[model samples]
Target: MPTRIVVDPITRIEGHLRIEVVLEGNKITDALSSGTLFRGIEKIVENRDPRDVWAFVQRICGVCTHIHAIASVRAVEDALDYRIPKNANYIRNIMTLTQFVQDHVIHFYHLHGFDWIDVVSALKADPAQTSALAQSISGWPLSSAGYFRDVQTKVKTLVESGQLGIFANAYWGHPAYRLPPEANLMGVAHYLEALNWQKEIAKVHAVFGGKNPHPNYLVGGMASAININGNNTINIERLNLVKTKIEEAQTFVDQVLMPDILAIANFYKKDLYGGGVRNYLAYGGVPTVDVRNPDSYLFPGGIVLDRDLSKVYDIDLKDPKHIQEFVTHSWYRYDDPQAGLHPWQGRTEAQYDGPKPPYENLDENKRYSWIKTPRWQGKPMEVGPLARFIIGYARGNQRMRTLVDDALKKLDLPLSALFSTLGRTLARALETKYSVDHLAGFHADLVANIKAGDSAVFNPDKWDPSTWPATAQGVGYCEAPRGALAHWIKINKGKVESYQAVVPTTWNASPRDAQGQIGPYEASLLDTPLANPDQPLELLRTIHSFDPCLACATHLLNREGEEMLNLRVI
Candidate 1:
């Protein structure tokens, strides 16, 4: 019998999600996105001094909190037209990069690697071969032939460390697993090494942020003290190790990571070729080093679609009328569910009419998700590596096609094999490689500039809220680890009068809209045939590719009903 199979609380990703798969004889016919928890973030911000908003709002997502902090501070500064100093600008860039590295490394190895190699498989791996491979990989340490062996020892210690907090709910073994025991052992060793490298980078964040999961950076400037002899005198030797780490990481990508991607990808080729939207979007990545002109970002803005993987279009985020938050098929009580209301004024309430049947279509004029349907220029779009790659490729950037083509050849994959779970994972690793190499030179240049005596930090004294300024709005957009992320803010009386955000995962996991159009997750699930409806591991594999964060996804387990519905139909 054809029946609906929904994978509730989708694993691997950061957030909570339930895949609502409409089945008809082995194929999924439809889907719905549900962001089941609602935290009164905007409500919490109301009636508070504007200065504290950065601290509170940044807690929205542990992974991309830096971007949120940057966006919030920029919006407030824009409202007041408070121009910062040059030193402050550079400091922000360095700290933001630290956050980026911390996020990317942990996510790639610790979270994604477990799927390919089973824990038990590691027990059988040849330690000698592992050492040889580490020697060959540029970034991996091999000074002590004993280093690789030592890594295995640490993995055992970590397992017994009682800090399995990292893998508390993780699925170590699934039916789909298939790696040689040797490879599994090698992965186990690298997993421990990766964890160490992640902490190494995290210390960089700790030096500046006070903590890793969440940090402290003020709206006016940073909290850390930069030791500039006068103004432009920077502490070079102090930051050189970080520079070397970036270099080492680049080497690993070119040798170990990319090679492994090709090998593992060869096996998952079939899984690599589905769930592509062809519509790609990027939320203008982080700003460049030059403080004078920010439009020139380390990563720029634009959108690309199936027709051309080469050309990108500028996205104007400041257009209030161009954005919206729809709640039609969702479970909420609002007068105009389809209205383009700013986030601070937007309402959020969980009042499901009933458990929406998995296969049936809801009202054509309402929403079925707690996630607001955010349309860029009013259109559905996919964001993340594919989008970023398309934009960079269209611009004829050097590394774009080269990496994609090389990966395709290594995996023995055809041209049509992109945008699935494996591809997403590979794209992330590849991007980290590129960013590491790119930043190495920039960091060097920063050192040179500092030695020349130019440290610019802050240039503000005090201002009255009553006389702050007129109404001014700006949108800060950047690519979070998962995908394109954006923050839309409007300021009044020097406070966060209004704020709205559209994160990357939201793009992939949106719910049904008024027209019954499936959100990205729903759309991706349509063509994936569930082999065994009772055990939807394939469904889990696809969702985990995005690495979503349920904590930041605006959901909660209702202790009242003992109900934990992270995703549900309105």
Candidate 2:
């Protein structure tokens, strides 16, 4: 008999997620991922001004807030055929890269680190040994015995006081944890350090976007105006502040984040459990000098099927035959449940007729999740750092290829290892290093352009809706920290006719399709071994590797402001 395990409201993530796995003995035979809440953001943005869509969409997820704004503005600009100023492009790039640095670091140290590091076990670590381990990895300034000792004492106090606060509710002494006490202590110390580091990193976003969580964005250009002398505009002092913050972020990545990931990877080199769907997709992000050209994108977009890197296919988001969403096993009412509709024609009418919540097992044959299956050319695709890394490595990108090769060499692992759970986590760390290293160059270019007297930021020509055609449609896409994200918008007489956002988690956390094909999250759980079915730490390791952000995936709320679906742990 297959033992069923249900983990509701998976903690430490952005939003509510419930994972159900049918385990035969100790290995997972099947799995189901459910996004329990729905915010109806697509419906809220309807009949609104097209220029202001980014502001509304930016609230989809607090963690992925800025990317939503960026994608929204890009979609509107695409429809208007608006070409923004070069300075605006550079400024946007800088902001995007800063978000990447802050998000990836936080994800690794805070969100996903607990999956590996045992906080309770850290209480037994020798601070001297932890310092030695840290020193062996890198010459980080904070790798001192005193620092590790203080971290160990703090953990001891938390454990003794029986109030871990943020460290509470974790599977602290799980058998799946492989790191030693010293390594766990090091991870915990860096975990606390990253909290302080991220605060400073957020200042970079405020410098350009006017706020941190949901920043201001303009369709034609960035919100910040370039003026070297004026106090009212983005003056020289503000630009210098941006430069200093970029340097601080870069130093942290080089000295702390990258080294810590490599150290953790060394401990779990042989554990190869979480290799999900091999088919990968990425809508290129971080545009270069030309925002319109895909070839100039820092992260190239393409589809790789069956892990075959040699044959990458170009994806046109506008092509109806390329990208489509299917709701056969989701709580959505489409004209045809089995049919896949392109985003421009997507609908979000809810139909929650599946099994009610507080149930033991999900009828996988029926609707199981609120997330619709998003397929690229009718195939399930994995997106995020792993996908971006694989796509970039396949495209012969020198910087990406070098980063992956060097990391693999350091770990003494073969290229095939990049397909496993550890590979996915390591990919995020490597990408962070690459993103932070390029921040200085982006800032320098922005300074040069501003000094050259190109102070233009916004284009007022298309700011009015009367200039638009009778009907216009466009797709705005960029790689969010989690994976590929795109917003499709349809406008008529200057008002939003239809707005659909196909987010990263929509692809990763989707359910089975009409043909009974499992999505990435479901497929990844097959054959995963469990040390303890009650704890299910091994399961979270794989799922968190994808960095699931359900806040952007499903968002339908009731009048009382409670989650409509009740998740019961059984």
Sequence-dependent TM-score of model 2 = 0.97
Against the reference, the lDDT scores of all candidates come to: 0.61, 0.89
Worst 10 residues of 2 by lDDT: 556-565
Indicate the residue-level lDDT of 193 in model 1: 62
Clashes of 2: 5
Please report the candidate that would top lDDT against the real structure. Answer: 2
- Candidate 1 per-residue lDDT, tens place, 94-159, comes to 666665555666765676666666675455556777666545544445424466567566656656
lDDT of 2 at 371: 88
Instruction: Please report how far candidate 2 places residue 337 from its true position, in Å.
Output: 1.6
Q: RMSD to native for every prediction?
A: 4.9, 2.0
TM per candidate comes to 0.84, 0.97
